[model samples]
Structures are given as structure tokens and as C-alpha cells.
Target: MNKVKENSVFFVSLLLTLIFIFWGVFFTENLTKVTNAVYNGSIDYLGWVYLGTTLFFVFFSIYLLFSRYGNIRLGRRNDKPDFSTASWLAMLFGAGMGVGIVYWSVAEPVTHFTTPPYGEGYTVEAANTAMKFTFFHWGLHPWAIYTVIGLALAFFQYNKRLPAAISSAFHPILGDKIHGPIGKTIDILSIFATVFGIATSLGLGAMQVTAGMHDIFDMPNTLFVQLLVILVATILFLISINTGLERGIKFLSNAAIICSVAIMLLVLMVGPALTVIKVFFNTTGLYLSDFLQMSLRFTPFGEGEQWIASWTLFYWAWWIAWAPFVGMFIARVSRGRTIKEFVIGVLIVPTLGTCLWMSVFGGTALDLVQGDHSLAKLITQDESLSIFIFFDHLPLSTLLSILGFAVVAIYYITVADTATFVLGMLSEGGTLNPSNKIKMTWGVIQSALAAVLLLAGGLDVLQTASIAAALPFAIIMLVMSYSLLTGLKNETVMQKGNKRNTQQN
Candidate 1:
């Protein structure tokens, strides 16, 4: 009874907080107006902080890779990885980005192309800038954020035998204070952030799924249709959660990767294969070349402030908000790997995959718009239908559209299943295997939150909620980086002492 009560602290606090927010948004008039006011206020004042912190995360992650601590194992020295390389990569990529990749692969580039930060609209210059910035948003920086959080959690939990929770990562910084109010607060915040972050993604997935249905089946893309899509997808994910991780998530992730690769191949074959290749390399080159400029960019001059706020700053906060769920899921599946392997695998592979995906989809869209001016207008009018519209210009459009819908559906399931698992673990005091009842409860709550947010204000509400949630968590992550470094140094000294003692004996 005592143990259950202790665990209930997190779950109960999170539930009540969510209830208050839901009431504020749905019941109270002008609540969303107030929310957006606060959201835009933060972006205007603190956009530079978000950009700078993300860059710091990227640098720190790279430092961990090449530092002496790189050789430190996450688990027992003799332990081996639980899953194969292929399976591991699939899960890592799947849970890290989810349906966003599908939704934005075409939409983002086109949106950028139409209103680039520093280029004329719908010209070659804008297209170039668009692809470059899209890569910037989806590339190394986001994965680096995930790497730091996952590394901290995995190191503390596995190496030190601490509880598998966010507060555990602060052990070096707070010591036993982690068991007090501070610790509880950190965990509570993590729970809230994870729920809101996943809810936002779920909301986006529902919108895209509705658009896809409208394209393929001639269904009306209305709020009612989107809610129905959410309901059906939620049911599917709940069923998936009951099957457990290995049987459900692993299988779906691998299958999604396969399908995604197939669709990419088809696009490459059918639409501007050479141009896609050339654009990929050129965009990659530009991204790397201007990486630093892009990383620290904020318009203090007030020239392009709104553009920066809408695109770059929003992405940084969104990634920060998502860090907890993606980070914890990565830690869960990444036991027994060395710190270097973990960093490299988590940071590089998925990023490369993202670049390739954007190249195929974004590249094709750019090519079509450049060749014909009308397609650019269509893209500007409805960004949701960008992928379907891009597909219509290719051969086997019907088959590819079906495959695209399947990939999105699978990604939706993976995100919900992974979020349920992580949320259960978090609320259950970091138990390795949380109860199915808890998982089901959180899953339902997540679906409800997504539905409510969609109805309240669609993408605007979701984005604001995510940014608000990210601010505090970003501070926590900064503290976590310090804790991880301190813990690694102590481990190094302890290991050397043991080695000397063994040699003398």
C-alpha cells in the first residue's frame, strides 16, 4: 500500500494538471487566446535561448562520443545487446521521429520554399534555402538532444543501478535530494512534458491521416473526420500495446522501415532520380557548410523575427519537448551498448535516414514545382496534401498512396505504444515493466488530450503547449548533462582504483 501510494504521487499530480489545462482550454472562452499570448511572448523573448541550448546539446553529445568515457559500458561488462543491429536501428528511428517524418517530409520543404527566411518565394534560390533549412530542422541537432537525455538516463540507471527515471539522472547534482520534493517535481514535469509532446505529434498524425484519406477515398477533410481517425488509430495502438514491445513495436517498426524504403525507392525511380541525388548532396553540403550560421540564428535586428519564430525556434522547442519520451524509449532498448556506440547509433543513423527521406520526397516536390508554376500555388494553398499531390505526378500513384497511408498508420501505432510504455514506467516509479492497466490509462489519456487539442485550436494549440512544456524540461536537460559528466568522472576514478587493487593482489 505504501509503495502504491508513493507511485501514485506522479500519476495523480499529472492527471490533475492535465484536467486543469483541458478545462482551461475547452470550457473557458479566450483560454486559447491567453495560451497563444503566452506562447508568442516566450518565442519573442527567449528564442535565442532555445537555439543556443540546442547547439550546446549537439556539441556536448559529440564530446561524449570522443571522450575517454566513450568506452564505458551502459550495463555489466559482460552484457551483450538485447536486440540485433537492424532491429535496434529500426526501433530507434521509429520512436525518435514517428509520424512527423511522413507528415513533414514534403510539407515542410514546400512551406519553406514559399516563404524562405532570406529568399524570394518559389524561385530556385528559395528552393535551395528551403531544403537546406529543412535538413537543418530535422538533422543532427534534434538527435543530439535525444542523445544527451538517453545517455544520462541509461548511464545512471544501468551503470549505477539507479531507478529508471529522469530524476535519477540528477543524482550527481542533487544527491539524496533526488528522493525529496525536487526529485518528485522533476519526474512530474517529465510526465507532463512527455504526455503533451506525444499528444502534439498524435494530433499532427490525425490531421495528415485525414488529408490522406481525402486524397485517396474522396472523404471530406473535416474536424469530424479527423476525430474519427484519431479514435480508430487509438484503438489500433491500444491493441498493439497489449501485445508488448517485442511482438508489437519491434515488428511494426521493422515493417514501417521496409515500407518507407520501398516508397523512397519508387519515388527515386519515377521522379527526377538524378536530380534527387544531386539535390541531396548539394543540400547536405549547404547544411553542413552553414550549420553554425543556422544553429545560432535569431533576428535581434527584428527583420525576420516572425519567420524565425515560426520555423527555427518552434522546432527547437518541439524537439526539446519530445526529448523525454524519445530519450527514455531509446534508453529502454539500448542496454548493454557502450557510450560511444550508443551516441553514434542514436545520433547519426536516424539523421542520415531523415536526410535521405527528405531528399526523395522533398526533392521530388521541389522538382515538380520548379518545372510547373501551378504546383507551387497548390503547395502554398494546402501543405497537408503536398505528399499526395507530389505522388500524383509520379507513376503508380494509387499504389504509392496506399503504401504511404500504411506507413503513417504504423508510425501512429508505434508512437502511442512507445509513449504508453514510457509513461507507465515514469508513473510507476520507474519500474522496468509497468502494469498494463497503467499503460492503458495513459494511452487513453493521451488520445483524449490529442482530440481535445485538435478541437480547441488545431496545430496552433499543440505547438504552443509543446513550447510551454519544453522550457522547464530544457533546463532539466542542461542540469542532466552536468550530472552525467560528473558521474562518468567518478566511475573512471573508481574503475582505476579497482584495477590497481586487482593488479597488486
Candidate 2:
């Protein structure tokens, strides 16, 4: 009790809870609507920029990793349950892919089957552009966001005397003055970015899950189901937050991965393995060959606004909203790693997961549509029902459905829990083992906030609002590029000077 008394986490948690409750009561629908407008209005070459920037970062990070910085290792480890290579990958996957696995694994693939990116001439076998599309969104650049954050924090805090936030990625150039109000401002902004980003995901994911329930079980798409999911998700988060990393988060993370993989296998056998593999190769090649052109291609402004919004803008908003949490979560797991190791494991491995997961899950869905027209109708009529309709095509529908739902349930737990856990750490100034009460507080806040948005705006409103917040943070992260470069050079030069003096003496 005393531990909870003077702690800022407790109060911050309370404040967030109140904010969520207040919004839930009155302004949720308003927030949802405003955000939607903001999101829809911003289209163009956004995907091009998102994809372009991500590619640049991926290449650039590889360059830096081979340089001297690549060799530097950081982080302080205690004997109890230290992290491993797999842990890093698991954490990265758990951070975003949990909710993502459930949501996009079906919706995205089907969306592409209907619209197929490279246009009408390509047969479904030759087309199925969704896997490539998912790969591009989920791949190297997003991981670079995480790589930069984790490397900076690991190097700064463990190797040097800096704090473990991504903003510290700039400390090498900024120097001691970074510790003043400037640092605090950056820190606060980081916190704000993380919250808004994850909030959108919470609302988006909760709504998706609710939609899934309605589709699968024929449950009414009611406010109550959304609320119940939010409430239940929050309770799980609180439990994991209190239990801390090893026991709570790890268990859920592993569970999610197992479920995800098992479902993929099931889908492959039941759906169509051969076609998805071929399409995966074809689309991946397409994604890679002209990566730069596509990444920077902001569909000509004159080209239909709706088309641009549906693809590029939506992807940009999703990535931007996800960056901070993914970045921070990557930082947390990335202590005691070299720059190269961190980048490859976090950025590369997860990209593979995204690509393959999309291939199998999305791939299977598309194959079914090609084989059976009714499958296409299910997708076009209701994106949420697409997964179950695919299930209906299978021989063992009952068993697969139970397994699929179980996977989704555990995945949601991992996502909601990890999100709340990261939030608590951010607000508490990067405490490794933050107070249980503090973690629980953020957990409850996130759950409540998500519930409100789900009830008022549904998925569209919830997701759009999160994207609106991304516009500003995008600039902030770009600014971070300058700060990181400036800081890195200064730190590097100073170290050389110190080494020279020691040799002379």
C-alpha cells in the first residue's frame, strides 16, 4: 500500500482511467467521427513515403550495423530469466502481430483478392497481391523503427549513462543538455505518441474481435459484446502487468505464437498449400523488385481519392500508430544486444513472420475465392465473416473454429497485456520492474478507453482517430533521425579522442 502512495504510476493510471471513463460516457462517438474524417482526408503518396522511408531505414541500419557501432553490446542482466534470441523475436511478434494475426490474416488477403494490386489481367494464381502487400507493410522498415529505438536505448542506458527511452537515441549528438527541459519535452512527447498509437490499436482490435464474434457465432453486433471484450482484455492485462515479464508476458507470448502457427498449418492443409506458396514467391518478388518506386509512389493526387485512402493512407496510419509501441517494446527486449543483432532479429525475423503468416492465412482465403465464387461473396459482403466462411469450406469446421478462436483469445491477451505493460514503463521513466499497481492501472485505462471507442465509433472511428495523432508523431520521428545522426557522430568522435589520449599517456 505504501509503495502505491507516492508513486506517479498510480496517479497517472487513475488519470488515464478517468479520461477513458469520461470519453466512454460522453464524447467517444465524437472522437470516433472526427478521427475518421481526419484519416480519410489524408491520402496520396502516403504509402509510398511509408514504404520508401522504411526501406531506407532498413538499408541504412544494415550499413550501420557492419560499422563499428554494430559491435557494441549493451544491457544489464540479472540471473533470473534473462532474455534470449528467441525472446527478442517473440516480443516483437507479440507486440503488434498478435492483434494483427487475428485481424489482417483474413481481411487483408480477401481485400486484395477482390481488388488485386497489379490489376485485372493477372489470373488469381498469378495475382493474389495481398500477401506481397502485407509483406511490404509488415516488413523491414517497421522493424527499423524498432531497431533504432532498441539500439539507442540499449547503447545509451546500458553502455552509457543515458535513460532507456527511444528519445535517448539522440543523446549522443545532443550531449548533457539533453537532460534538461528539452529531454523532458521529448520524453513527454514520446509518452503521448505511444498512448495515442496504442489506443487506436486497442479500439481497432477490440472492434475486429467483436466483429469476428458476430460473424462466427451469429451474435448481434452489439455494444455489449464490444464492452465485454474490452473489459475482459483489460482484466488479463492487469493480471500480466502485476505478474511482470517472465511469468505473465512470456506465457501469453508463447501461447499466441503457438496458436498462430498451428492455425496457419491447419489453414494450409485445409485451404490450398501449393497455390499460396507460389503466390508468396511471386508477390514477394514483385514487392522487392520495385520496392523504391512503390514505396515513394503517393498515388497521383488526381487518381481517385478513395482508392488512395483505402490502400496507402490506411497503411501509413496503421504503421504510424504502431511504430511507438513496437519501437518501445523492441527497446525493452533488446538490451544486451549489438546493433546488428538487434536489427536483424527484431526487424528481419518479424518481417518473415508477417510475410509467411500473411501468405498462409491470406493465401488460403484467396485460393478458396478462386476455387469457389461463394467464398468471394463472403469476403465482399462482410470482411469479418471471411475467416469462418473459409472454415465452412473445410472438412472439420467445428474443430478448426475452436482452435482459431482459442488462438485469437490468447493473441489478444498478449497484445493487450504487452501494450499496458509498455505504457506503464513509459510513464514511469523506463523502470525495468515497475510497480504492479502502476502496470495494472494502465491496463485498466487502456481497456476502458478501447471499450468506449468500440461502443461509440465502432472500428472505423477508433482506427481513424489513432491515425490522426500519427501525422504529428511522423514529424517527430523524422526529427529523431537528425538528432540520432548528430548525437551518434559526436559520441563516436569523443570516444576516439579518449582512446587517443590514453595511448599517448
The candidate that wins on lDDT is 1
Lowest summed lDDT over 10 consecutive residues: which window, candidate 2?
72-81
Overlapping backbone residue pairs in candidate 1 total 0
Clashing pairs in 1: none
Question: What TM-score do all the candidates reach, one by one?
Answer: 0.96, 0.87
**What is the per-residue lDDT of model 1 for residues 1-505, given as tens digits with 9 covering 90 to 100?**
8876787656565666587566656664565676688778778787777987899999998999999999999988888988888998899899988788888888788888877898588888999999999999999999999999999999988999988888899999899888778888888888887887788788888888888899899999999999999899889888888888888889989988999999999888888899999989999999999999999886776688788888888889889988988999899888999999999899988889999999999999988888787887786677667788878878999988988988888888899999999998888888878888889988988888888877776456656766776876788888889999999999999999999999999
The digit string of per-residue lDDT tens for model 2 on 405-491 reads 777677777777777667666666666666677667666666666666555554455556566666666666666666655655666
Best by TM-score: 1
lDDT of 1: 0.86
| Residue 354, model 1: Cα distance from true site in angstroms | 0.7
lDDT of 1 at 480: 88
TM-score quality measure for candidate 2:
0.87
For candidate 1, the 10 contiguous residues with the lowest summed lDDT are: 20-29
